[model samples]
Target: MEQAKDLLAKGVLKPGDYAYHEGLSDWTPLLEVIVANSEPEASPTPSVGPSLSTAPTPKAKSNATLVVGIVVGLMVLGGLAAAGGWYFFLRDEPMELVKTTPPLKVNVPPNKEVEKILAREIGIWKITGHRLPVIDPETGGPGKAEDIRDTIETRWKEKGKSTVSTFSPVINGKKVSFVGYKEYDAKDGVFIWRVKGEGLPETVSKERYDPVTKTFHGEVNYQNNTRELSTFRRINKDRVHFKSKLFDADNKLLGTSEMLFTRLEKKEPDQPPMTAGSLTAKEAAEVMAWVIGKWETKGKGMPVGGEPQAIEITMEARWKEEGKSVEFKYTMEEGGKTVSYFGHQQYDEARGIFINRSKWGDNPETTSHERYDPATRTSRAQSMPVSPAVGSKTTTVTKRIGQDKTQQTLEVYQDGQLVYSHEIVSTRIGRYVEPARPEPAPHAPQNGLVAYYPFNGNARDEAGHGHDGTVIGARLTADRHDRADSAYQFKLGDHIRIKGLMGKPKNVTLAAWVKLNGQQGRSGADIISIGTSVNIRVDSKSGTGGSSRTGRGSWLGTNAKVNYTDTGWHQIVFTFNDNTDRQVVYVDGTSMAASRNQIPIFYEGRETDTVVGINGRERNAGFETQGVIDDIRVYDRTLSAAEVKALFHSE
Candidate 1:
């Protein structure tokens, strides 16, 4: 009975639970037994008569003292035995040492319910739906989308005796990542999640699971006292639905989001890879970068009943799967009725062509094969009929003009004859900006160097000459050696200008590392120029490299293309020797052009500033450099062949 009471007080046993002891017929309610009389005290013995004599005999007194000493000695031995039993046996078990003992902590195994919940969530999920756009009540227009999309991967891990699940959502091309951990609190019947990541505030949230509905409801607290009410429901083994509503500090509803997650199926080991044409998915997607923007077109449709109908069309394109594919949406309005179409485009390696699949509401899908030319910015596509029995084949020729405009021509053919044709001129929604990527910075010796521009973030001269240049519309990029911000990339209208030397040198050599862009043509682009007299430029007709003067025409022509198609970095050197009457142009350490009868370069006293990327005298688009330039150096004396080779291999 005492032991039962002690266990009940410490909460090791519940009061209402049944318990049994040696004397009980069967287990009985602990409550009923605890309240029952604890082994009733022995009935009091009958009262004995008082002794009459005040003193006893000596023999009788000695006998009473011996009896008292024996009882004391036995009690001491029993106490020592009880202490030893507690130290060896009962120390590891829960015990109620006193009436104020705290409740014992139970170390029960995790329940099956928590494991089942975690199993349903631990898998790779891809977002199938995006947050809906908020509509403007006044204009009835929708706002832009938020939190575009990404893949989410989660797994459950063991931390000591507890379960911890990890969550990370990854977005392609972005450096930021989110980390989260979840643990179950059985006492509170809730699961808690703590999340933190780059550029995000730490959050701790609690959620309750509903087994019947397979759903979870939670409240997430953010910074500034703001909170969000969120719910997640498992629709099936491979799908989950999530919704959240954000609330301000004052409890005002701000916004809401909804998303659908679909588990990614595992790939089969024997499945072939996805690829197209001569390019990989990423390369194929990048070839469409010029068209990945909003565009609008207005044209007269094919003649209908002796009159052409007015047609308006708009299109938007975006990259998907990290540039493996391109997705496009377009809206067309004809005869006052609007129709929309969505399309996906990718390269088909087997077909050696680009393929486009398009669909419209309730309409049969159409597929087209296109042959695209990057150099010409043109594509010829033959689109099949939505139904083989009803429509003729349509051919489309699209030509991109400059950066912001495109022209498309469509023709329908039937019975081997052209039936109808339409033309469209689409203008981009905004001004187009060309992308220029940086290259690795190369190294070179400083011997006899007059001016050197490493271009490391700034255009400061590093050759002990105060000839720093002013940069315009240029971006710092990695160099030839993959050094970040060690070089500069130049696009259209980008250049660097430095103060010209006080006087012309008797013999001079100009060298620079250049990486030509894909858009460079066979003509009219200047690399470096000093005034109008001396310049290293792409010749007017051949795209070959050369140095030229105003009256002398070209002093030296390399007759080698500027390496636009090759897409590799190359070193260009132009040396003029006054004493030998020789002018030599070298590309990648080998002399491509040399002149023994050339006159010395002349510099007028009023020469303009030294210019890089374009002509010093002419600042037009015709002479704009369409590439990256790095590690430019000017020397007062010509360099030998060995020194030129060293500069080329320095990287």
Candidate 2:
């Protein structure tokens, strides 16, 4: 064991350096060892002890440990060498070898040729794939297979090929595979071409024959960790039909399908024409002319005749005469009452034709007609009653001439026999005449007039004037004046007397403002006069015959009594109804007296001219008005009590 340890230390017999030979039960190193022997000397010396191979001495513990350490160190060195060898020679070596084959060329027409073919084909033959040959068909060569595939795919897109596939088969006792296809495309003008490939399924696999393009247009899985390949092809011209297949790792067929694609058509467009009747001016004018004029007819008791049950018709139509035609219409009244009646007269074309229509009370057929008669200056026609059973009559004539024209006479006939005749002149000579002198235009009362005179500015005296009176310079002081009388006046010497005037003096209203000064005694002292013919007086001195009576009197001494005061300004209004023998007087807005005993008698004789400022007794007679008096207004018609009050406060 000691010798063994020494040998081991000298790198001679480590446990792993040798293996025990099975047959020999001895250890031997597996590696061949070369030994160099110098020429052996001729003698050999024999050892002296028992001749047994000297039993190896037991090794010391330290030597054995040293030997084991040496052996462990050699083992570690051997393992490191093996690891280094594996890393340098085998770790990064490629797992797969790929042969990049050049793309196969398809014997198809050029794009220009295909385009022409597409135009003629119209509905079939779609080109699927094409490419320039990268490798000679006779000699396989290396090329960029992906670039070739991309070129082929681009051509297929352009040509629209279909049904390209790869196929595998046994040929001539050898397993061979190839790509086969067919292309139905417009480039082939509706025909399909079959294509086949050589030597592809063994190193690479293809699916099926598409009969149109020489390409593998489907998925192929390889067994030895090869990349899968897939192809696509289009078959139809107007529509597209494609074929695809998948292969397994053992190059076995997995699946297949025929897919179809179709194209859409277009659609055609929509399109309506361009020209219409209204009233002419002449026709409208003709219709409008038949509605204008005034017409009149008289029956019993009408305005023209004095019968209680008279019927009268009057029509006023204006501005409806047109060229050669005239129209007129009339309304009817019977017995001072209205009854239904209508009449229309139309003349056409200078009296060439005349139509007369008359309707009365549900009798529409009581119409007549007339034609122009140039020789007689008339229009003559026939007439019939509303009942058709009644006989028709002849010679209804409307005279066209003025003044002394042919008259119209009515003769009723029954059964062609005259039953009654009524002779009436429809148009008379001088039927419408102008008067020698034109009548004067009627006068309307100026009811809204304001008082014009009287210088005093007191409003109480101006009450009945409908407005405030103006003040002016006068004989008396401006602040001390008498009320003006609206009553017409005549003067006895210089004494003003109230009297009647022209133009219907029967109905009269006398309004004034007055203020009495003293109860005086006098005769014929006039407050107002009608030209010395009639007078309105106040006798404040005595009640009756002594002129102390406050009363309103006429020229004939017919008087109506009233009350008066010597206080301030007061409005006095007097009204007379000669037709009814009644008289009324108002003070302020209240009625002082309404009397029938002192009736107002219309004065027949004319009076002297009117006077103002004072009566004819200019020395002692004016108004005994000691205070201011102002406006007055007179009317030719009797005024009611309400009207007098309204006028007082109207301002």
Candidate 3:
């Protein structure tokens, strides 16, 4: 007590400090105890100590109650003080507290979590292997399916914080037909994948990733009609394995597919493929782009049960599966009927070969495998009958001769012996351009010239033979030389009637300068024709020139290989020598078609009016030229090959 009084007097002991002893019920501040025990004592220096009175301070009747109240009040006060003190202390030494305190676990932001997973997917991935469940007919159970190739590209978007994925499947190797996005919902604490594709319903899947196993699991809902469970396991930085199991509405397992993805190294666009195994569908499609067009094919071969004969085949090819494959339609006129066949060709990346499939009516399908040589722009193909009972086989070699031409040689074998062969030439029905050539000087051969219509702003016969023509429904247009109103543009129902022209002559030559608009009607567009006597027209099917007796079908006409019905200016000439009963057709100074010992036109000697731009008998029908005509000429005698060349050069 003496030591405590001395310490209190020197201000070393604070009032809030508690004092305890064995007799005390609980800790009590010394200030309250001292004030309770002491009386007021007068001193010379009253300010140096707390005020004291000789009489004792009034106390509660229940000392125990007072002690309890004081203790509770002190505890409450201490808690507030301690809290305030810790706040300041933490502000001063935050790292020290963190090092000593137990840490709390919290979730990362949803967007951040999404970024963590997709970052591994940002690159090109190829389907190196695939397996599908197939039904076995013999056992009525599941069997293994073959593998195929596909490509997928995942890239970063939205400032590199988000990712979007795109896929180019084998069905359409040239286009990105499938697109997908990955998103996260913070409120739901889930990841979602929304996928859409061409001809496919949009699919949504909720997914979760397990970092422990480096795997992602998803439950997919396809427009509420089907469901699938998918798993993707990341084997390493460059490989992933994916499996999907499809279920029916009743929760029955229907099928399962598995794929192995491997990262692909980027290559330059112009670089050739390193190997056949690494060829992409897009690259293969590019190599075949030149084949998309209409083509006219001509060849001669002996049929299996028929005599040898000339064959004319018209083929049209176009893009299918968004350019992954080329689809073809072929038509051949035989025995007054058209025989049609449908086929398609596509690249098989797995086998490094081209597959061609064809079907003819109800016949079984025929499949062929081809190997391509990029350096020579050629493909070699071999085909065998599906049934081993048939020993017939075919081998073909197709080569690209030019931008507008190709040549194919086909050989057939039966029982290891050569049975027949054919060489077919295909010509594209258009020109690169009509090269501008200087017109020959106005010195055409005049020995056999009988009538001429220069069409130089008028339809009068320039030869001055009084074979003037009257234009109807035809309009003047620019000539091939770009001279205004020097040519005539013909449309449906448009024609020019000429008087005194369709007489029977011993030998005759018909020539004209033409510019075709495009393809014309089925019966072909007439450049000049008479009533069932003679005609020169564009063969609509082949886009070439044809000459024959008027009203004769295409089978009876003499068609040329030169496609005069191209999108450019051309000069066409037809010459006939009645003595030899030989006829020749020329386009742009080259002989394209010839015939001998055929029935001559106008043999019955009919003198019908000559009509230009449409057949005289089918006026106003769909057989109009659909083209422009200029510089028409008629000769009473056969024009020599040189004479025809001179006429073409005369422009």
- Indicate which candidate wins on lDDT: 3
Each prediction's TM-score versus the true structure: 0.32, 0.23, 0.31
Per-residue alpha-carbon lDDT of candidate 3 for residues 418-467, written as tens digits (9 for 90 to 100): 78888889999852231233232386877777777777555767776667
Q: Write the per-residue lDDT of candidate 1 for residues 308-398, one digit (tens) a residue.
A: 7666888877653335566676787644766556677767654456767776654556667676766667777766543542224567888
Per-residue accuracy of model 2 over 448-476 as CA lDDT, tens digit each: 32222332212111223333211111122
Listed per candidate, the RMSD to the true structure in angstroms reads: 31.4, 56.0, 36.2
Model 2 misplaced regions, further than 4 Å: 1-504, 518-521, 532-534, 541-565, 597-606, 612-628
Instruction: Quickly count the clashes in candidate 1.
Output: 12
Q: Against the true structure, candidate 3 has what lDDT? A: 0.57
TM-score of 1: 0.32
Query: How does model 1 fare in lDDT?
Result: 0.55
